[model samples]
Target: MPNKTLRVERVTKRYGALTAVNQLTLTIRAGEVFALLGPNGAGKTTTLEMIEGLRQPDEGRVWWGDVDLAQKPAYARQRFGVQLQNSEFFELLTVRETLELFHSLYRQRLAVPDLIVRLDLAEKQHARVGSLSGGQRQRLALACALVNDPEIVFLDEPSAGLDPQARQNLWAVIRQLQAEGRTVVLTTHYMEEAAALADRVAIVDHGTILDEGTVDELIHRHTPSAVLELSREVGRDVASALSSVQRVDIQADALLLVTDQLEKTLIELVNWANDHQRPLTGLKTRQATLEDVFLTLTGRSLRE
Candidate 1:
């Protein structure tokens, strides 16, 4: 019933020499959706598990309001809900039955009928868990997490395997939860998902936090310049001739140039091309995005 603030301070988890989380510290404010984003093996799930009281950390602490998770795990867990990367359901149980079972377990039961409808399960309420589609089952798992009307919810890849429409439906439900003043912590590999839903984001890599901020702020911080793509091959001569360009790199078959003066760069390129009688073809320019920033920082893709 009290106000909630989820905090993880200097948390570390390890297995032999392979550290899973390395002295990570993060805070999720009340009623905000904070996203933990990283590639596979980046220790995202490990960090979330420790905070959920499912995995104890080797060092540091997790707190739910004033309750210390390592010291009082039961008390901490009761205040939040978790939809893990893999959630299990009784295969034979109908959707309504599953909701009823979870409802009975919680000290405070949310209205199953309303929840079922809100989660878009009204028609499938009678369907057995095993018979539902992947998206349907995903929605069911999310509904179970909310059956307790938890003050905080942790969702690990809630929209991973769902279709675009189904993912959008889930996003709508998440927004509604935030609108109701419930704090949500989510882990996702999808950049667009984080950009669209998260109030703040933490980019994790190598078992540590690399960057954290609003989507726009992060993009602006790391990739402060625009990129111009040219169709022509970047030969040794052409590459050396681009002294007017501050930074020049090749991505795929395109050349990425980061510069403070786009106009000057374009003018120089045009003059050089005219002097050499070489045509500048297929030129395009775009502002940097979160994907560009992440790739620049991590030197890898989100799914890699």
Candidate 2:
């Protein structure tokens, strides 16, 4: 078992009559990548802020290892680094100069050049913040977070808007952080991103957790069906004929059929196609994924 580095016990936060974060309890292990997943108003950001000491919980308590965050906020803040979803930086400052400014605030700082390389900012060390692209700015924010050489790090929506290649690069940097045995907690709506990087994930909705576990565990627990997709050409009639399937939907050029009896469904579909002289092209079968689990629990997709 991994060491529990951060613990939140029945913590709740509210803004007037609206409860942004309901009574929530969770633990983040040392050297693990834990993802907080939900929609825009799902209290993910509020929960993260509470743990990071930026906001106080109306009830319950938060502990950073053995230190009580409410009692000693400064100590808790020192133990962890944070990269907010949108942070303000001096537009006129060069990348190197920005690091120097942040380093001054921490008693123990990581090497500036080393952090830049780790975050893939080596070529942009002297580039002004105002001139960097969206991806470059994100990388710079990540670099700034590491200056403290913290035991744990919090990244809120680290990859919100970026090209595919840029997102891939940012993922590589996160993997590097994991390899160095730093506990990382991040919030994201991208299911694939959570699937790729998280050791465990917490699914939240309406200010509460619907499920929490490894990706496979959550999917298995919430989504029991297998997905069989076929080309649009033969999907309509075949879907109507699928007695074993619980649900079927059209997505672009493919048909998504959800069923527990995969073998029986496939055999029937194949036999029907063969008898009708209609070959089913683009036939693919996959197990239920995190997205399926999200839909099952929340009655909506994560993106919705």
Candidate that would win on lDDT: 2
lDDT comparing candidate 2 with the true structure:
0.87
Give the TM-score (vs. native) of candidate 2. 0.88
Deviation of model 1 at 261, angstroms: 2.5
Q: Residue by residue across 1-304, what tens digits does model 1's lDDT show?
A: 4567888999999999999999999988888999998887889999999999899899999887887888887775666788999798999999999999988887865899999998989999999999999999999999999998888899999998899999999999999999888898999889889989999999998889998999888988887567677864645357446766765656666666766677778887888888888877768878876777777788755655
Best by TM-score: 1
The CA lDDT of each predicted structure is: 0.85, 0.87
- In TM-score terms, candidate 1 sits at 0.91
Q: Number of backbone collisions per candidate, in order?
A: 0, 0
Error (Å) of candidate 2 at residue 296 is: 1.1
Give the Å error, residue 42, model 1.
1.1
Model 2, runs deviating above 4 Å? 1-4, 230-242, 247-255, 267-284
- Alpha-carbon deviation at 118 in model 1, angstroms: 0.5
- RMSD per candidate (Å) reads 2.4, 2.9
